[model samples]
Target: MTAKIIDKHCAQDGDLRPQHLPQNSKTRQLNLFEKALVPQNGLFIFSAILLVVYAIAPAAVYLIAPVGESFLLLSLITICAVTSMLLGSQISLFDSRFKPSAPRLAIDRRVFIAVTWLIFIAFVLITFSTAPSIPIWTALRGGATSNELSQERGEFLKGREGAGIALLYISTFLVNTIVPYSIVLLYRVKSSLRHWAAAVFFLFCISFMQKALFLNLILPLLVFLAITRKLSTKIFLPVIFGTVGLLLLTTALSLAGEGGDTSNTRSSDYLTALYAPSNPIDYFIWRAAAVPIFTATDTLVVHSEQFGSRPLMGATSTLISSILGIERINLERFVFEHQFGGWNDTANSNAVFCIDAYVNFGWPGVVIFGLIIGLTFRWFKISTDIGFQSLWLIFAFVLFSAPLIGMLLSNGFAYMLLHGLYIRVDRHGT
Candidate 1:
C-alpha cells in the first residue's frame, strides 16, 4: 500500500507511461537515441557545450592573446568551473544506484498550510515595520526603485546588533528559503492555496527590487516541475518566453521606480535602455555572470604577494563560519578594497565556485568542487524517483547552485548534508 501511494505520487499526471503495467515494469529501457532525447539529458549536453563555446573559448582567447596574467588566471578559473560541471554531469549519468526514495516523514497538509500562513504574515509584518511609509501598491506599480528600497532596508537594519541582527538573519532565511520551499511543496501536492500564496510572495520580493531573490524562488520551482515531468515538454517554448517576459517586466518596473529621470520614462524607453547597443545583452551577461568570476580571479592575482595558497581554507572557513554564525570572509569586498582602495557594501558580488576553490587550494580544489557539484546534480536526478519529497531536494539544489556563482562554500552543501541526515533518521528511526 505504501509502495502504491509512493508510485502514484511519483507518476507524472500526464506521463505517457502505460497505466496497466506493474510498477516494476514501468521503468522503460531506452535506446541511445531515445536517451539523448530526454529533456534533462538534452539540457545537460546543451549547457556543457554552451559553457565551452561562450565562457571557456573567450577566456582561452584572452589567455593566449596579450590580455596579460589577469586574463590567464580568469581563463584558468573558467576552465576549472566548466570542466567540473561537465565531469560532474558525466559522472552522474553513469551512477544509476543513487535513485530517489520517498520521504519517511508524512507531510501533514494542515501543518503545512498553518506554517505557510505564519511565515507569510510574519514576513509582511516585518516588511511593513521596516518601511512603514512605503506604499505596497506604489512599489508594485514600479513607483519605487530598487535603490530606494535597498536604501530603506539598509536604514532599518542600520546599527542593529545582538538580538536585532539575529532576528534579521532568521527572517531573511525563513522568507527566502523556507517560504519558497513550502510554496513549492504545497503546489506539488495540488493545494489550492499555492496560487494565492505564490502571487503574494512574488510581489513581496519584487517590492524589494532585488532580482536574485525572485529568481532564487522561481528557478527552483521551475526545475522541480521539470524534473517531475509536471511541466509538459510541449509548453517548453511557452515557458522560456514567459520567463524572459517576466524578467523584462520586472526589470522595467525596477527601472521605472528609480524616480527623477527614470520615473517618467515610457515602456519603450525602458526596453530600449535594456537592449541598448553600448549596454546590450552582453552588459547584463558580464555584470550578472562574467564579472564576478573575473573579479575573484583578479583579486587572487593582485593579492598573490600577500596571501600564499591555502586551498581547503576557503571552503573550510566558509563552513565553520556559517555554523558558528560568523561572517564568511568576503572575497568580493577584498577585491573591491584592493581595486578601489575601499570596500563598498553596495558594490558586493560573488566569487564563483571555481575561484573559491582555486583561492583555497588551486587547480585541485577546482576539480574537487566540480566533482561535488556534479554528484549533487546526479543525486537530485535520482531523488526524482521519490515523488513529492524530491521537491525539496530540487528546490535546494537549484536555489543554491546558481550558474557561475554557487558551490559548497556557501552552506548549500552543508544544508544538503543535514537534509540527508534527516532523511536517514526519519527512514530508519535512529
Candidate 2:
C-alpha cells in the first residue's frame, strides 16, 4: 500500500507533488506543509462555477424578472458550477498530473514577526483613517462625511449633473483600494500574538463597534484554523451564544442610560458597520447573486442615471455605485475610465467579467476565461489541501466575496505565467 501510494505521487522524472501524498503512505508526514499549500481541483471548480453562475445572474434576472429569464439564468449557472465541481472531482481521481503539492519549510520566525507587526500596525491605522466619518476638514485627517461626499459627487443628495465626478471617484478608489488591500496582504503573511493583541486594542478604541467584532474575532478565525486541528463546533457555539447575549444586554443597558458615551451615534454604528450573520454572510451570498443581476440587465439604470455625477459616497451611495458597475454601466465606465476595453473582471465580479469578455473577445473569450479561472483556483486549492479546515480556504472565500472578479482573474493569470516561467528556467538550468 505504501509503495503504491508513493509510486502514484512520484513524477516520471522523480519529482514529488509538493502538496499530495496518499493517505496510506510512509512519506505522508514528510509532506505536511506542502500538501496544505496546494490548491484543490474540487474547490476550484466548485467556486468557479458558483462565481460564473453568479456572474451571469443579471441575464437570468431579466429572463426571470417577474418570473422571467432571470430565474432560468440563475438555475443554469448554479447547475453549471455544481456540475463542474463534481466533474473535477472525478477528473482528479483518474489524473495524477493534477495532484501536485506545495513545499514544506518553517519560515524564519524573526523576519515573519517583523513583517507581521508591520502589517497589523499598518492595517489598524488605515482602517481608522479611511472609516466612514464626517470630513471635519480636508487638510485635517478624518474620513469624508456622507454629506460632504455627496457634494464632492457634484450633485446634491437628491440631484443630478453629468459633469463627470471622475476625478473624485479616481481619488476615492486610489485611497480606499490601495490602503485596504495593502493591509490585507500584510495580514496574510503576518503571524504574531502581540500583533493580534494590538489589533484587538485598536478595534476596541474605535467607536464604530462592529469593527472590533470582525477584525478582533472573525478575521482571526483564519489563524485559528492555521494553528490548530482540535477545533470542534461543540466548543465554538457556546462562546457565540455567550457573546451575543452579552452584546444585546450591553446595548439595551446603554440605551436605557441615555447619558452614556453618546459621542458616537448608536443608530449609525448599528446600521452602517454592524457585524451580524445576516450582514456579512447574507451580504456575501446575496451580493454574489446580485452581481450578475446588476451587471447584465438594465434594471439598475434607473438608479445610475439618478446618481449621475458623484455616484458612490455613503452606505446607500456605495450600494447604488455597486449596481452602476453591472454589465452595461461597467462597460461604459471601463470604456470611459480607461478609453480602450479589456476582457477583465470576467471571473471575479460574476456577470461583469462575462459581459466584459463578450464585449472584448466574444463568446470564445468568455468560455476560455471561465475555464481557465475555474481550473486555476481548483488546482491551487487541491495543491494546498485547504478543504474546509485550512486557513488558506478563507483566501478563496474572500476572493469570491469581492465586489469585482478582477483580483482572482488577474492573480491567476499572473501566477500561472510566473510559475510556468520559473519551471522552464529551473528545467533548463538543471
Candidate 3:
C-alpha cells in the first residue's frame, strides 16, 4: 500500500523516492527554535516584526528621542510588539504539531476547467459590453490615463442595479478567486492549453488597467511554484525580469499619456530611483508600512471618544448592514476622510487591516485581530499538511498569503467557503 502511494505521487510529481516518505513510528521531531522557523509561520512572524519596527521607528524619532520619554510612543510600541509576539507564538504552536500526508481525493478537473472557461468568457463579455473601443492591449500597457480609466470604470458600474449588480459581484469574485485557482491547476496538470487560457485571462484583467489584478494572479502562481519545489531558476529569473519590465512599461505608458512633456530622461530617473534605494528602511516605511500605523495612531488620538465604540466589522460591513437593513459605516473610509479631509480620486483610500481593527475597537482589537489571522494561517498550514498532494491547498495558501501584509480578513469568508467546498479529506481513501 505504501509503495503504491509512493508510485502514484512519483508519477504525479515526476520525482519521488521511497526513502523520502515520513517514517511511521519515528517521525523527525523539530526543536522549539527550529519549529518556529518553519516557512509558513516564520515568514508571517518576520513580517509582523518588520511592520512593528516600521510603525514605531518614525514615532520614536519624532517623539521619544527628543524629550527622552513619550508615553504614547512607548504604549504604541508595546501594543504592537505584544500583538506580533502573540501572533507568532500562535502560528508556531499550530505548525509544530501539523503532520503532512498524501491527499486522498484529487481535484474534479472537468468541473474546474468548465467553470474557469465560463468565468473567463463572462469576464470578456462584460469588458467588451462595458467599453468596446478600449483596446485591451493598450490598457495592458497602461496607455490609458488613470482618470480616463476610472471614468470608464464608473460608467461600467453606473446603472448596474439589482441583478446586474449581483452578477457583477459574482463575476468579480470568480475572477479573483476561482480563476487564479484554475490557472494554478492548469499549470500543475501541464495542460497543453494552459498558456493560451492564461494569456486570454491576463489580457482581460489588464484591460481594466489595474496593476493589482496582475499581481494578484502572478504572485500566487510564483508562490505556489516555490512552495511545491517546482520553481526552477530559469522560471524564477524570467518572472522577476518580466515583472520589473512590465512596471517600467506601464509607468512609461502612463507618463506618455499625461499632458506634460514625456521625456525618456524622466522615465529613466524614475526607474533608477525605484531600484537604487538610498535609504531602504525610510523608503519602505514611507511607501508601505507606516501609513497604516500612523493612521491608526492618529485615529486613537483624534477620535478617542469613538474608539472601541463599535464591533470589529472586519470586512462584512456591507453584507451585515444589508441583512440588518442599516447604513454600513465604512471604517476605513471614515478614517481616510478624517485624516485627509476627503477621498482622493486618483489614490487608493483604504486603511491597513490593523488600523481597521484599531478603529473598530482599540489596542485589544489589534491583539485579537492578530491572533485570528495567525490562527487562519495555521489552519491553512494544517490543511496543506493533510492534503499535500492537492494543488487546491497550494493555491489557497498562496492566495491567502498575498493579502496578509495588507488586509487579513477582507476575503476571509469567501476563502473559507472555497476551502470548505473543495478541499476536504476523502473518507474512502482513508
Candidate 4:
C-alpha cells in the first residue's frame, strides 16, 4: 500500500528524470523518471508543500524576521532534500549495470571523456581570449572620498589588463562552467577520464585570479564529487550531515542579523512604506490573498515610495555616458542610487529585477516567472545527455554558479531568463 501510494505521488507531475543524478543501489533508489511514471500521492503532496512554502515564505519574511526567515529556511531545506532524493534515485536506476561494481566504467557510451575534456580546454582558451579588460581609472576613481571605493580598489588591486589576470578569470569561469558541464556530458555519454590532466591544466589556466567565482560555484562541485567518489560511505555520511548543519547555522545567523533592530518605530517606518499590512498573516492576506480579489477596492491600491523608472533610466544613462567617452562611469552605482536612494536595505540585497519584476507586475508575474524558471530546468534536462557518473557535480556547478553570477551582476530577471534559456537541454545532447 505504501509503495503504491509513493508511486501515485511520483506520477502526479511532469517528466521526473532530471538529467543530473547521483549513482546508488537499484532496489532502494527512487528513479525520478520511472517513479514519475508510477502513480503516487506522496510526491504530489511533497511538490505542493514545496511550491507553497517557496511562494509564501518571502511575503511572510517581510513581516517578521525570525518567523518568516525560519519558514524560508525550512522551505529551502525541503527543496534541496526532495530534489536530492528524487535525482539520486533516478541516476542509480539508470546505471543498473554498475550497481554491484565499486567503480563503474562506461565502455559502450559514445561521449568519450577525452573528447569532452578537449572541448572544455578549448572553451577555457576562448574565454580568456575574449575577456574584456576592466578600466584602471574606474578602480582609482573616488577612492579618497568613499570607503566603498577603497574596498573596490582592494578587489581590483591585481590590475585587470595583465595576461596573468586574464588567464585566471578565464580558467576559473571555465572550471566552474565548462568543465562541470562537460563532466555531465561525459557521464551521460558514458566516457572515461583518461584526459583528466589535460582538463585540469586548462582549468588551472582559466581559474588563476577569479577566487570569488571559484568559491561560490566550482568549490561546491568539487566538494560533491569528492564526497561520492566510491571511496568511503562513512565519509559521505559525515559530509552530508556537516553540509546540512552548515546550511542551518548560516540560515539562523542570517535571521538573527535581520532581527536585531525590531523597534516599533522602525516597524512603523517599514509599515508606512508598506501601504498594506502590519503583521505577517495580515501582510499575506492583504498582498497575496486579498489584493487580487479586491482589485476594484481603492484602499487596496498601494503606492510605492520609490518608482522603478529611475533605475531603468540610470542604467541606460550610465551606459550612454560610457559610449560618449566619459572618464569614469559606474552603471551599477547609478542604478542603485536611483532605485534605492543609496540605502542599505534588503532592497539592495539582490538585483533590482527580483523586486522590480513584482513592483511592475505583482504576484501573477512572480508565479509566471517561477514557472518559466521551472520550464527552463526541464529544458536543460531534456537537451543534455548528462550521465550518472558525475552528474551531481555538474548540477552543483549549474545551481550555484547561475545564481551567484546572477546575483553579482544584479541581473535578477535577466538571470532567470537567460540562464534558463541558455543551459542546453541535454547534458550531452547535440
Candidate 5:
C-alpha cells in the first residue's frame, strides 16, 4: 500500500521519470541510454540544455557568423564536449548501482531557527551595501521596473568592483552558496520551521530587487513538494500559473518601457535574429529555454581569432588560481577589450562552465570538464533521495549559465551535495 502511494506520486509528469523503488539484492545498474530516459536523474536535463544552447543553436548562428565570423572553428569542439558528457555519464566511480536507501534527518528547532535568522541578516546587509535604493520595493510601490534601471545597475556593479569584502559577499556568498543550501534546509526541516524560513526567504529575494527571484526560489520548492505529494494538485497548479503570470507581466513591462531604444536591436544582431520573437509567447520560449549562446561563443570566437592555438593556461579562473596560489587572469575582460574597447560589468560576457573549461585547456579541457559535469550530475541523483534530487534543476541552471568552479567551492553546492549524500531521502520517497 505504501509502495503504491510512492509509485503514484512519482509517476510520469511531462519529461520527468517516476522514482525508482529501493533496490533489492539482485537489481542491476542502469546503463547510459537508460539514464538518459530518466530526466528525473538530471543528467538528461543538463546534457539536453547544453546540446541545444551550447551546441545546436550556436552552431546554427555560427553558420551565419552574426557577431564574429571566426567562431565557426569551435563548432566541432562543442559537439565533442557534449558527446563526451554522455559517455562520461556511464563511467561511474561512486556509482550507486542499486536504488538509493531511505534518508531522514532530525534538526533541532532552535538550531534551524538560528541558522535561518543568520542567513536572513546576511542577505539584508548584502542588499543595503550593494543596492541602497532597493529597486524591487519601489517597483512594488508603483515605480519604474528593474528593466528601466539596467544601466544604473550595471554602473553600481562597476563602481563596487574595488571593494573586496562587498564584492565577495555579493558575487560569491549570496549567489553561489547561502541561499541554495538554505533551500535544502527548508526541505529537510520540520513544518514549524517552514513559515519562518519562507518569510525570511521572501524578504531576502525582494531585497535583491530581482523580478525572477520568485521563480528561482519557489519553483524548486513546488517541484519537490509536488513530487513527494506534499502539496495538493489544485494548490500546485494555481501557484505555478500565478508565478509564471507574474514573470510574464514583468517581462512585458520591460518590453513596453524600452521602446524607441533600438539599442537592443543594435546590441547583437545574432541574439536579436536568433530569438527574434514576434510576440510574448515566442519571446518567453527563448528566454526560459535558450540563453545568450553568443556571448560565450563569441568570446571563444574572438579568442580563436586573436590568440589562435594558445589557451589561457588556466588564467581565466580566480577559483583555480586561488587554490594553486597563482595570479588570476580575467579572460572576460580580455575578450571584452577586443570587442567593446574596455572591460566593465556591462562589457564582460558570462563564461559558462564548458566554455571556461575550453578557455583553460583548449580541446582537451572540454572533454575533462564534460566528464566532470556528467559525473557530478550522476552523483547528485544516486547519492540522495527525491527531495534533494529535486535541487538538480537548480544546480543544472547554475551550470547552464555560470562557471563550475564557482558552483563547487565558492557557492557551496559542493557541501550541499555532501549533505544530501549523507542525509538522503525517505525510502518511500516522501
Candidate 6:
C-alpha cells in the first residue's frame, strides 16, 4: 500500500481522491516536489495564480502607465526579476532540498480548542480597538457622509504612521488572515465554534468597511472548498452573483464625493493618473488590474533614478527601520510622495514585493532571492497532507505587499502560519 501523507488537517477527503501518475511516467518514482508541482495539485494551481499576479501582471506596466526617464531600465530590471523567479520555481520543483515526511508536531484536541478560543477573543478585542465602530453601520443609517465612511472603512488607524504602521499590519493579519482562517479550520471539523468565528469575522468586516473583505472570505474559502470537496460546477452561479454584488458594493462606497453629491466622481490619484473613464466597471478594472502595475512601474522608475546603484538595504522594512531609528512608513509612501508631494501619510502607490525587492537590492537581489522565495513556498506546501491550505490564499495577497522575508520578519504572517502547524484536525467532526 502507498503511504498517504500524515497531516493535521489531513482529512479523509484528501486521502479519498485518487492520485494520478504523470502521463510520462517511468520506472523511476516521482519525488514529493514533482508531485506537489503538478498542475493537478491544488498547491501548484495556487502557485500559478500567484505567478500571474506577481510575475505576469507587471507586464501591464508598459501598456498602461506612461513612460518615465528611467522606465526602460526599470522594465529591464523587472523582466530580469520575473525571469529569475520563473527559473527559481522550476528549480524548486526539480531539486527541492526538503524532505518533510510527517508533521513535526502534534497538538492535543483540548489544547487546540482552548487556543482557538483565545485567538477568537483576541481578534474581537483588537478589531474593536482598531475599528472602534463599524463605519458602514452608521453610513447605512445615514448618520455619516459616504465619503467619510469610505475613508474610515479603508484606512483602519489613519491616526498613526511610521513604526505605528506595524500595528496596522498586525491588525490586518488578524482580520484578513487569522480570524477567517480559524473559522475555516473549525468548520472543516464541523465544530459549533465556527459560528462564533464567523460572527467575529463579520464584525471585523463591518468595522473595516471594504467590499474586498467579504470577497477575501468568499473567494479563497470557495477555492479551498472546491479543492477539497466534490462541488458541482453549478456552485459557481452563486459565487458569480455574490461577486457581482461585491462589485456593486465597491462602486456604491465611492458613489458620493464631498458635500453629499452622489454624481460627482471621486478624486483619486490613481483614477486621474490612469485616465480611466468615469464609470463603475472601468473604475474597478483600473483599480484592481491596471493601478497596481502603474504604481509598481512608477516606483521602479523613480526609485532607480533617486538612489542610482545603491540599495536601501533593509531601510524599507519596519523591523529594520525600528532598529535603525528610521521612519517605518512603507516604501510605497515614498513613491506616492514623489508623485503627489504632500504629507502623503494618507495614500500609497502599493505594489507587489518585487518592486521593493528591486529597489532594495537591484536586479541581482531580485533574481537570487526570487529563487529562494519560490523554494520556501513549495516546501511549505509539500508539508501539508492536503494540497489546499487556506494560508496559501492569504499568503499570496501578503506577498503582493511584501516578500517571504518581509512576511516572516515584519508583517505578522509568520506568527499566524506557525500558529496552525501542529493543531491536529480530524475528518470525523473532531
- For residues 33-84, write the lDDT of model 3, one tens digit per residue: 3233333554355445535543445355456343222225434644573465
Better candidate by lDDT, 1 or 2: 1
Go through the candidates in order and give each one's C-alpha lDDT. 0.49, 0.34, 0.46, 0.33, 0.56, 0.53
Q: Which scores greater on lDDT, model 3 or model 6?
A: 6
Which residue pairs overlap in candidate 6's backbone? Answer: none
The RMSD of every model to the true structure, in order and in angstroms, is 7.7, 13.3, 8.3, 14.1, 7.1, 7.2
For this target, which candidate reaches the highest lDDT against the unseen true structure?
5
Best by TM-score: 6
TM-score of 3: 0.65
TM-score of 1: 0.67
| Cα lDDT, model 1, residue 248 | 59
Output the better candidate (3/5) by lDDT. Answer: 5
Work out candidate 2's RMSD over C-alphas: 13.3
Candidate ranking under TM-score, highest first, comes to: 6, 5, 1, 3, 2, 4
Per-residue alpha-carbon lDDT of candidate 6 for residues 153-214, written as tens digits (9 for 90 to 100): 54665545566555566655555555555555555554656555565565555455565665
Model 1 residue 81 distance off true place after TM-score fit, in angstroms: 4.4
Off by over 4 Å in 3: 1-54, 57-61, 64-107, 132-145, 153-162, 232-234, 259-316, 323-325, 335-348, 385-413, 416-430
Q: In candidate 2, residue 399 scores what lDDT?
A: 37
- Each model's TM-score? 0.67, 0.42, 0.65, 0.39, 0.72, 0.73
lDDT of 2 at 275: 16
- Model 6 bad stretches (over 4 Å): 1-66, 69-75, 90-103, 129-133, 142-147, 158-169, 258-277, 305-309, 324-329, 385-388, 401-404, 416-430
Greater TM-score among 1 and 5 belongs to 5
Kindly list the per-residue Cα lDDT of model 1 for residues 244-301, writing each as its tens digit: 6666555555445543343454433221222222222333454544444455555665
Candidate 4 error regions (>4 Å): 1-24, 31-57, 61-176, 185-235, 241-356, 359-368, 380-384, 387-430
